[model samples]
Target chain A: MLETGRLDHNLGRMGERARALGVRLRPHLKTAKSYDVARLATAGEFGGITVSTLAEAEYFLAGGITDLLYAVGIVPSKLPRAARLVEAGAHLTLILDSVETARAVAAFADLRRVAFAVLIEIDTGEGRSGVLPEAADLVEIGTALEQPPYCRLQGVITHAGHSYAARDLETVARIAEAERSGAVRAAERLRAAGLSVPVVSVGSTPTALHARHLSGVTELRAGVYMFGDLFQAQIGSCTLDDLAVSVLATVTGHHRDAGHLLIDAGALALSKDRSTADAPHDYGFGLLVHADGTPFAQELRIFKVYQEHGLVRAADGALPFDELPIGAQVRVLPNHVCMTAAMYDRYHLVKNGALAGEWTRTNGW
Target chain B: MLETGRLDHNLGRMGERARALGVRLRPHLKTAKSYDVARLATAGEFGGITVSTLAEAEYFLAGGITDLLYAVGIVPSKLPRAARLVEAGAHLTLILDSVETARAVAAFADLRRVAFAVLIEIDTGEGRSGVLPEAADLVEIGTALEQPPYCRLQGVITHAGHSYAARDLETVARIAEAERSGAVRAAERLRAAGLSVPVVSVGSTPTALHARHLSGVTELRAGVYMFGDLFQAQIGSCTLDDLAVSVLATVTGHHRDAGHLLIDAGALALSKDRSTADAPHDYGFGLLVHADGTPFAQELRIFKVYQEHGLVRAADGALPFDELPIGAQVRVLPNHVCMTAAMYDRYHLVKNGALAGEWTRTNGW
Candidate 1:
């Protein structure tokens, strides 16, 4: 179920978009968090995987995946894991933005006589984790890595996470272009300093889809595109039909007085991730769907979430909950499918309305 | 650690309060989401347990723990799992507000002879789930067990989740009284109908702590007390020291431009569950703690969360963040400990500044 239906479509579209952009599609596995889904993603394609966790990279490597990028910047406490990945002969790229990190990685790798690929993250106007675009010293520090004991400077990557706040697709497009241009400019600045920037990466599912024409961006690293969620749908990146995952739930009780039906799948099952709530259509928890993959009537909306119960409210503040039986099974399309999927250790796949299989997930540092 | 310093103390006090009110505390297990901590809680003299998911209940029961209540109102899709619990000789209490569910459970249980201690969920105004207290027909429906082939009714229960919004202890106390009175009144109505109402339960962590007496309340359910978080603390309910568990993360990168350090712990590690953000001193994500569990320096705040990256904003707001050496391990106190812990497959116990044993968890339905 992890690699079914719209998942394949999304994966194909991402690859196609990458080809059209003349860049490598470095789809991060942190989105699906499923080995089966990752396998489908890499199947028959020259895919360079990006992972936020060492466990994910290790999972892919164990499955014969060689090209991988530990995209979430590495810290000193888990440097040993990064060194191990490089030692295991996996083509690993590490993300870092500080001279202190560079010095530490260099010292550790020098001791092991193994040089690793490192990318200095650049902040492209997004006040999140990254070095300032004008901070050329940060890039120079990466390039100054000691050969035997240090990491080799790769290119730079930027994630315009704030692009989701754009009011329209036009603004999102502008943000995407600016994000790509920023990373490219940083890479150009490094190249002028005589360093060969191998990979210029840009992220954020919204920006990636919109910035396919941004030429200087060598590789597109986007997760969550595999599972179009309320976030993606809200940003005008995908339609509801594009979503590949949904939380399976059951109607527990009906409030005939207030007009709502309680469901077993609440925040516990659906996750309390409301990252996309800022979007125009901010459903609190998720959109309720019938068991057959079709969404329920528009009258029903999951408006409130408790630790273990979801309150389905009607559009007009009255629950027409009589439409659902007390025991009917339903699927809830969560606010952020990436966070929602991460909550579960496995995915229960349904294809043609039949239980296909269970695809397990791995999680750790 | 589920049973940590300040949170342990708070839960202890709340338990005492509940016991004094003549309500046996069957605290929900969904909050802390740890068996070791829960076992420790039970060892401290809890009478029964309330679980949101059957998976949790099964995990506890298989470990020789019993007296369980599947508190998230009964749904038809999960009837078989509930029946299985009854078949295993576990004293199970099921919650549902509708006769439709009662009839369904009755039909399913009649065959298994699964005599369930069903609790008629009364809506005492938190309004997430349950029948309204004035829905007098609900009591008749519960006592109408002879009309069904499925399950038996035990009594009534209500959760005043809205008490969380109280501005002070006085408001929390008032809400608690109302909640207790509402459930008691419903039970009275049931008794007036010649129905033998065995248990009249009402609770919420805030109410359980502030309310002096339960009046006619027989049982208490409070989960978050075991591992209180920022949201709890913000309601003047718990303090910073009371946060039991935190996601121990590694400092991966520092955003100099944003004056923030990046940690591996993000929304995926620490849940985005901020129910009381409308309150004063609404902490974002959660407060960060040092290795020894003391709060991080005032300059450091976990301001924003990506899927797997916590942007630790520095107080100075400087773009020259190259000070912190990479690889520093930091522990992040979560917004809601229970939901955050649920995202992880296991717990890495940090006791006396060292990694202790690993505690595994069961996921899914």
Candidate 2:
């Protein structure tokens, strides 16, 4: 379920922050996969968005959003689908870090008789994917993209994913700076090689919110900020109150002796994302809240989860059985909203303490 | 993807094991939520299956499998849907551990004028859910069901989920015995109270496979055994060679300096379940294998994962960069198949090293 008021607040806050940072806020739609959420997120801004999958690209393209960045590294097998999107009038941009993928994307684009705006993924200290800012491969990939008639080297993109591990505001800001500088450096390297480097994209939720400046970066991308979660809250990205999405579960069983309340929402409902485990506050699976989205006086957390059952318990080993009887409705704030939201096909929109309507979302590739 | 040959082998082996143990194998459809898999699993059985959600209950019921035990504890809010299944000629059985839920179930059934087969879930060492076999609530819940004109006391059911943590076959066998005795004892307690007790179900993958005898148990329930995962293989429930399900991923990027190969399958594709973290051999995210389902010469494990990217590294700290270049297809055996399989909408059936067909699955409640 999603709280529309909080959703709007989050979207507005991020948009305002991005405007302040002087960059186009390409809201990553991977968190809130709903087109309705996308419409609200991109309202009063450039319609370009960031997606993790070609499926999301296709969904948003069909929903009428044209400009999109397929943020994850491109594999050859996915090119046909990306090509289809591009042919459908989507300004679909693909990212790659290796010369092999650069060649493959070029070959596929040429064979399909389509053009693709390609970006070189720059390593911004995450070490997950992307070429390092100082690596020779950075310019080599940029040069390779230049050789293909159908593949245009748009710019360089980097994500400071390691910013999520930041325990302090100072660390976040530092990572954010590194993210900005790395992307900019890679873009400058491409430009020095006599190539066009139009777009320099850099951001993650932590980095985006904490970044002091994004000097050379043309655009910023962040996804999880829209639906703040327990992990984000713990890491100081967003406070607990800023969380927009939650799992609406029914109290199914009460274990008085064990001081546990069983909810219908388990691993599948509330995803198996234990991201908050290493954080200052370890919400086992999720933090439990009342139906009206109010936190209890005493802290309650889902201690354990099965496929379809969540074992909830209070911090003090005391449960208010009378107050929270079987059949009572409660909402669980997930550790990671992106993982949790992926389980449901639609979001029940909650407004003014009641379900207003439902927003459908696309899932799976 | 699902290997058809191994799927058939798993189904046959489990069936023979259940028959030898003198109990009905009510194969849990929660793991492989496919009508095609259910058809093969119940080809020669009584056609009864267990489900973790009402969605699966409805899906399987629509697919003409009428005997379904909605294995998860049923909340009052979900009764209307459960009633619809019962009304649709499904012998849908609901399980509960508390009198609160029992009263609510009975009240809903009486109000709707629909009969529901109710089972008292007995806690057989796994304190996740279920009433203890020795608890007074067991008979009380049975008595509550008897008072309702539309609710029938079917029997007792228990799952030894703690068997997953057992390192040896002896421990699993011990847990299996406890699971059987607990359910039988609960049934005896219900019968002693002059309540009709016809069914006694007990099982978990480890417990089911290791149980020497299930004398009093009428049927056994196990799901993940059908799609043996890394965690299961470690716990001795099934061998690694017996694993029938794996996520098909494409090599998207190669971080030669980092000694990591990036796969398109990450947290969303291959779930964030770290069930094997404490095991003897911790397959970080998942175990990578060849596209033809063959193991690599050096053990390659996905060490880190992003939303849509998996960072794979070999145990020897060396990657076969030349052999496993960009765009190469590989399969990853999940840490927990139930969690991993839920992310996918359909399973690409692989038989004899070739794609056979696709099997669709139902997700969400």
Candidate 3:
């Protein structure tokens, strides 16, 4: 859960950043899969929301967020579902990194006599998805989408997911620059091939925050910035206090000999992300905080976790077990807010140390 | 999803094994969180069921699984909910690993005027929860539960979770024996103190599968075997072919340069449980299979995953790219079924190459 004040602050910061950078902020709604948060994030508009699944696309579309980008690679089997969203008056956009998927999208659109807007995904050094920006495959995919009456190349989108592994700002900025340049170059190539690649998008929380400028980028897409996590904090994207989301858990037991406190939150509650394992500050699973979402003791962390039990202890062995007795409620700042938040069905919102409201979120594909 | 025939085989094997060991099979419904599966696992009896959460307890109770044991350590805040289940004619059994919790349960029962059946969780080397068998704390917890008219000392329960880390059958057997002996010893100590400790429960998927004997153990509570995973297969608990649960994914794209196939299933669909990282066979995130759940390639696996994209590649550089083309359906044998299944609302069942049924599941805390 997050305090509305802090959440607003986080959202305001990102919104301001997008304004200053002169790019449309198409916030990815995958992280905070809540209609309430999305409404606040997009400032209550259908203005270009990004989704990772068709489920999310449908969810947000039903909530009146009709302008959606199903950001993952589009497959033929899922074309009908994506088409249904488009049929329901959603300006849905599909992305693909391969010509095969592009052809499939073309075929599906041709068969169904439906117009489909698509983006060519560029590999901006992530080595995970997309075609290399300089590769001939990028032009091939763009050409494949451009050849039909039903298919049109909307733009090129790239994600610098590798930016999270950057240890310093200079590296993050460099990766961000690469991400921006790669997507821009791919878009340029598509334009050179006589295709109207209208939109250019690039982002990842670290890269989005560290990018000096958005030269050819038209819109910024980032999700985790709204709910900063320990991984982002360790990477210098956000401060520890900037983290908005925290899992409220009850202390189940205390082991005097082992010098630890056990909480109800575990792998199921906090998730076994461990994204901070190689970071500067390794919060074992998550950092322990007061019920009001402040650090309880210096360097306290959840050192271990089972399916339903989290073993909390001081990192430097200062031993705060006596203070955190059984039945104590503590908030755990997650290592990855996206994964942690996926476990809970709703958010128990707090504002200035008081229960404000509860917001329900959707999950699964 | 699982093939019904394979699931039946897995369930029947475990049931037969429990019968052969001369113990009651109290199948833990933590893995398969479906009423359809639970009914089949328990063979249509409210005799006993082990759950990891109160959500499961309430869910099963609604479906007539009355005899339930919450395996997680009981906390004071959760007592009212557990008491409600008991009040609703559920023969619920509560477990506590601490004297403070035992006293809290006693107080809750005493105040409510309800006699609660309680078990002292014994640490059979898992150390995650439970009192050590030889420790005075075990007897102390038992003594606290023995107070008249409030709580009755049911017995002791231990889980050999350490058995998962065991590399050999002998080690797993030894851990299973330790689990049995530690729990039996705790029960014996309670009996020595004139407490009528009636039951001794112990299990873990690996331990339950390999245990040669259960001399004094009254019941074995094991989950995951009903939906065997790669970690269990790597630990030699079950063969790879015996795994029942798998994520049905569609190949969204194929990157020729990267020599990998991208699937729609990623962290959200398959979950990010890297439990087999240190195992003999590191199946990456999960092993790739055909539409009918047969291995596509001998060593093909989902190498890396994003939020909604899975990068699947052959481990030995023998790519099967052409075989698994775009839009092709594939089943991924999960690293851990419990974590993977937690993401989906229902299991897409297949029996003998046909869609049999879809079983809905319970999730969240």
Evaluated on the second chain alone, the candidates' TM-scores are 0.92, 0.98, 0.97
Stretches of model 1 off by over 4 angstroms after superposition: A1-3, A146-150, A297-299, A316-319, B1-8, B44-46, B146-150, B296-299, B314-325, B350-356
Q: Is candidate 1 or candidate 2 better by DockQ?
A: 2
Which candidate wins on TM-score? 2
What global local distance difference test value does model 2 have? 0.91
Off by over 4 Å in 3: A44-46, A147-149, B44-46
The reply for model 2, stretches above 4 Å from the true place, is: B147-149
Per-residue lDDT, model 3, residue A247, is: 92
RMSD for each of the candidates: 2.6, 1.3, 1.5
Q: What lDDT does each candidate get?
A: 0.76, 0.91, 0.87
The second chain of candidate 1 has a TM-score of 0.92
Task: Provide the fnat value for model 3, as a fraction from 0 to 1.
Answer: 0.58
Q: What's the chain B TM-score of candidate 3?
A: 0.97
Clash count, predicted structure 1: 17
- Sort by DockQ, top down from the best: 2, 1, 3
Clashes of each: 17, 0, 0
lDDT of 2 by residue, B1-365 (tens): 89999988888889999999989989999999999999999888888999988999999999999999999888888899899999999998999888888988888889999989999899999988898889977788998888556899899999999998899999999999999998999899889889899999998989999999999999999888888999999988888999999999999888777888899998999989999998888999999999999999989999998889999999885899888988899999999999999998999999998999999999888
Interface RMSD of each: 1.7, 1.1, 1.3
Candidate 3 local distance difference test against the native: 0.87
State the lDDT at B231 in candidate 3.
92
